[model samples]
Target: MTTQQSASLGLQAETKRSSVNTAPEAPPYCGGDTPARRPEFFTTVSSLLKDADGVTVAVLRIDSPPVNSLGSQVRVALGRELDAALSDDKVKAIVLTGTGRFFSGGADVREFNTSKTKVEPLLRTLIARLEQSEKPVVAALNGTTLGGGLELALGCHDRVASPEAVLGLPEVKLGVLPGAGGTQRLPRIVGVAAALDIIVSGDSMSAEKALRYGLVSEIVQGDLVDGACRAAAGMAKGVVQYRRLSHKPLGADAASGQLFDDARKMAARKYRGGIAPMHCIACIEKALSCDLDEGLAFEAEKFQELVNGDQSKALRHVFFAERQAAKIEGVSREETPRIDKVGVVGAGTMGGGIAMSFANAGVPVVLLDSTDEALQRGLGIIRRNYEATLKKGRLTQAQLEQRLALITPSLDYRDLSGVDMVVEAAFEDMGVKKSIFTTLDAVCGPQAILATNTSRLDINEIAAVTKRPGRVLGTHFFSPANVMRLLEVVKGDATEAAVMAGIFQLAKRLGKIPVQVGVCDGFVGNRMISHYTREAYFLLEEGATPAQVDGALRRFGMAMGPLQMQDMAGLDISWAARKRQAATRPAHLRYSRVADRICESGRYGQKTGAGFYRYEPGSREPIPDPEIEALIRECAEEAGIRQRPISDEEIVQRAIYALVNEGARIVEDGMAQRASDIDVVYVHGYGFPAFRGGPMFYADTQGLDKVLATIRGFHAEHGELWEPAPLLVRLAEQGGRFSE
Candidate 1:
């Protein structure tokens, strides 16, 4: 403890003795002429405390639950307390602290797009009052202080934070920039470059790092409020002068044109079509050149624009959809079965990644394979993955070792006998999956939940081989499972509701977005993506070049074009799936043979250096190939179809609408719980741009009538291949959106 804190708080004797077991009594207040009095408390969303020391300093504790988001009520209460504290001559200093896990969660996201947010004493207005206060105001950051919360702290005269506190302005991720003076004040404290980086990326930094950057005045060790009280008392004694960030000069010259230019370029490449990141850079640049008030006005203007724009709307939809997807009706989390130990079958890429995910989440994993050699190879792959992440500075060596220690590799099924759950990520063949499940049923304990990681196989058929089919479900993790965020929890016809609920909880615990889907040839994501890729193939055969089609969708904000996506995923994989379906394919249904023909010619995408496009040695970059074009033309000729020029708009509509049409069918068939769940699957797993929402939301944005007209036009031209889904037709006729 510092000497000022010792004198102000008067706990030096108790702290120094070390042998005192009793709780230390409250010390005398640091005031002159007036005797100490008991604390007088006032309550709202926050609690206001007038200390006994002649009320020299007042402590306001924000008590909003969960994250202490600055809702309108909290803002109103805070405003009233600030007025009271400033008006009272006895209260010479004011200290602000949070009561729980968050110092503040920033602005209340739930209040966005609502009247409550615009109520009296807006976050901006409250911040202005905080900055303009005559008495010294100290912000005691106790925990996660973010967004408007950090902006609030920036406005205070002095800032102090706990060692474990994390600070950030993360509005960019929600497709907006900080509006409450964050863009202007942060640069003055952390410099323009750092402010730009932090705001653009929307990532939090540890309080220790904040101290190094001089963002915080002090790092309080224990009892954050008490330290803040002592600090406030010292300010009341005129030991520290009020520091206003707005009055401070920026760390860079306004004429340093290259800094902003570089930042803009980086944001453009990193965030692509994301508008908020670029806007954030502009805000920081404006802060460097303009006055504080002018910069704040500019920031608010941009923030309002984003809050009303389509990109922010889509991002917000995704945020809410993620929360809604977790709320499975009739399934309570309280009845969830415990999943302490997990077993991952197979030693291929998918199985290894799944094992790593469990280990990363601090869960013990038994990785079972058919042979010792295969088990060793899988473990080796997992170690290399961790080492690569370590090289990228995402993981420490100790963390890598700790996660690795949680995975136990074995060659025998008996080793998985004690596991509470077993995930079979074996080959995606029905016969193979059934055989694996049969063995698992025999070896695993009766309570073990059997999960299949099949991308497009029949979960019910696989479950039928097991004695306990009620406990069997499909937990489909996307490829490179540990890295992907989506978990398609496939609910089989006979799977228990409690089992699904348990898997839902487990997926969240493993840090994945679990979307419940019913059993089908290809669950929600792949089912919808099937039509998306099919349209891309049709477009190719209809005279659209790979570059033309891919470029249009990429510009539309898809992470990768369909052809390029195929190349990256290995064309042979889809070709195999197609061939498997060929036996059952309806004769009237038009099946494009372009991809299959490419596979037959020994062009299997990145794995073989050629598929829809060709690749150079050691590079995944796809180059347009004239040979593939010739092959596509040949297929068109063989199918007795005439090729015509296809426009980019047509290409995009065909691709995305195909997804919408299939998604509508999935929802109508009860294969997907809701339209939003399909959206969640696409956004998290399929690289669908969050800014556009998902296929279903995009359809709503485009209008169901327009989409229906387009689908009808395609159906007239291509017959069965472009048939409109029945649900789409109904919704269009009624002028209703998929969300309805």
Candidate 2:
């Protein structure tokens, strides 16, 4: 602790230690000839009993450094000062302020992890004293007051806030709520409707709005401590008016017949899997109709239930896990490379959208294509995207125009002169991609980065063509790039850290989540996706129809099943990639061998009016095609693979676990930095269900041992394709998560 802070705390103890461990009725601000007092206390809380002329006011200051958390020492010292101010006849109205910038910031977050150290009742007892004090208690909110901090201010008779202050109950965001009298006091003042809104949203309002909502009594601009002392003096002399929070009658619109019913339904829709918002609604309704004691009792009972629930635990885990993920393992703030100008090749759907993302964040972009017409079309796509944003009120016309003006589209390769980086979203063919890189190598500056948007290709080989191979990388973007959030940043064998750092910065600017991955055929995302589709195609080889598989996946919350998704994306695109891989597939590894056969039969998905299922031009309905089903049975019979009944559980498990097993392999091989990074890709790139957590988290939840056992069982029954990843086996044996 700082020397100044320790001295202030010592003064607090010297002034108020005599009235320790007690709560009592208080007196006015001062009496004649009263001695000025400073007390000895812990570094957490500070106090001084000063006489302004004839009136003495005990100022209880919470001084715990770094947010002044309402921890054990803070409660003890603060309770002591409240006791002295209430019992001493020499002391009149009390003033409560913080030593530094912040008032109490609620209970210490670290302390909440324990079961025994929570001292809410002790804090409440002191707050109850201030609420019932004969002498007025004024709160000086000088900073952001939240959770238990706001609850403490609620206990004061009058609240005076600094202009810079914002007060709210933001606890709901962290898997908990304001259990320390927030439910009772907030509804008491703001009423159930407004209080419930604030609680559910977890958004803090400004001091100005707080005043408008009657959350605080006054807004003081400068010298907040002096303003609080003046209020104490005014109250002591009967010069300024103040209202007690406890005596205020409840508002008429607290809860009518339709109010609570509407609340339950609304919460049901928005918070589908979430339980906190629903419990918050119930507590608010109880507060609306019940007495103060009854309301508090109900609030405590509900809090007890939610704090011990599984949903809270899950939400809390995700919260902390995300914080942990943001900190790069070996990279520090100083080592990160800055990105300025970016160049994007092809100027097609993905390239234009990707370029627009960088330009939107004020990064200069050079968009390259072969012809002026193609360049114009790409620029048109950028403008149309912004214009749509303007139409939707997501951006103002001027802002949209500014973003549009940031991009420079041209047909010449020389236009990429000073760009810090270039992402090539050219044709999927290796020959076409390699030719583009040769051109990029000749045109772009030596220091400039070159990245390809190839979904499934050898990044290392592509890097081999460049003079500075370390400057080349893979920046794979999903289809309709502007909409999707994930960017798989693939690092080649020779890729430099500065090149990666530049890409990471560019991804952040593009409003895309960049996850660093190692170079491989498909990197992390498409590699797993390829495995998922293989299992789906195999399911068709069995007795289960395509509709049955789609039904099962949709029931499990997938956006679309494999067959439907293929039709939407145009199956020929995947068929082309399949032919590339089919040339080298090992005889031992299981291949469904159904996709290309369908494409060869002139089924190019919805674009060509047929795929796994037939599609009518405008309508997406895939009517049961006897032709496809017949082909599946014929292929299975010819291959001597027996058809059997596959249960729904079997279907879901096979599809999910195939991807999970591949994800394990990627983690084991160091293709992905972390398992959570794999989860982020699936969550953003693929339509992975969030409620199940990510695939890795889901695998952990399902038990890694069990997942490994299942995969081993499949490997024994099937061939080499079902071979378990070493990481999965290790995690299973050690009983640790992939992230662990």
lDDT of each: 0.83, 0.75
Residue 72, model 1, lDDT: 73
Pairs with steric clashes in candidate 1: 29-53
lDDT (Cα, tens digit) per residue for candidate 2, span 305-366: 77676555444554444433333345555766666888899888889988877877899888
Per lDDT, the best of the predicted structures is 1
The regions of model 1 sitting more than 4 angstroms off are 1-44, 50-55, 248-255, 332-334
- Reference-based TM-score of each model: 0.93, 0.77
Report the alpha-carbon TM-score of model 1 versus the true structure: 0.93
Error of 2 at 245 (Å): 5.2
lDDT of 2 at 59: 78
Best-matching candidate per TM-score = 1
What overall lDDT, based on C-alpha atoms, would model 1 receive against the true structure? Answer: 0.83
lDDT of 1 by residue, 598-656 (tens): 99999989988998899999999889999999999999999888889888999898899
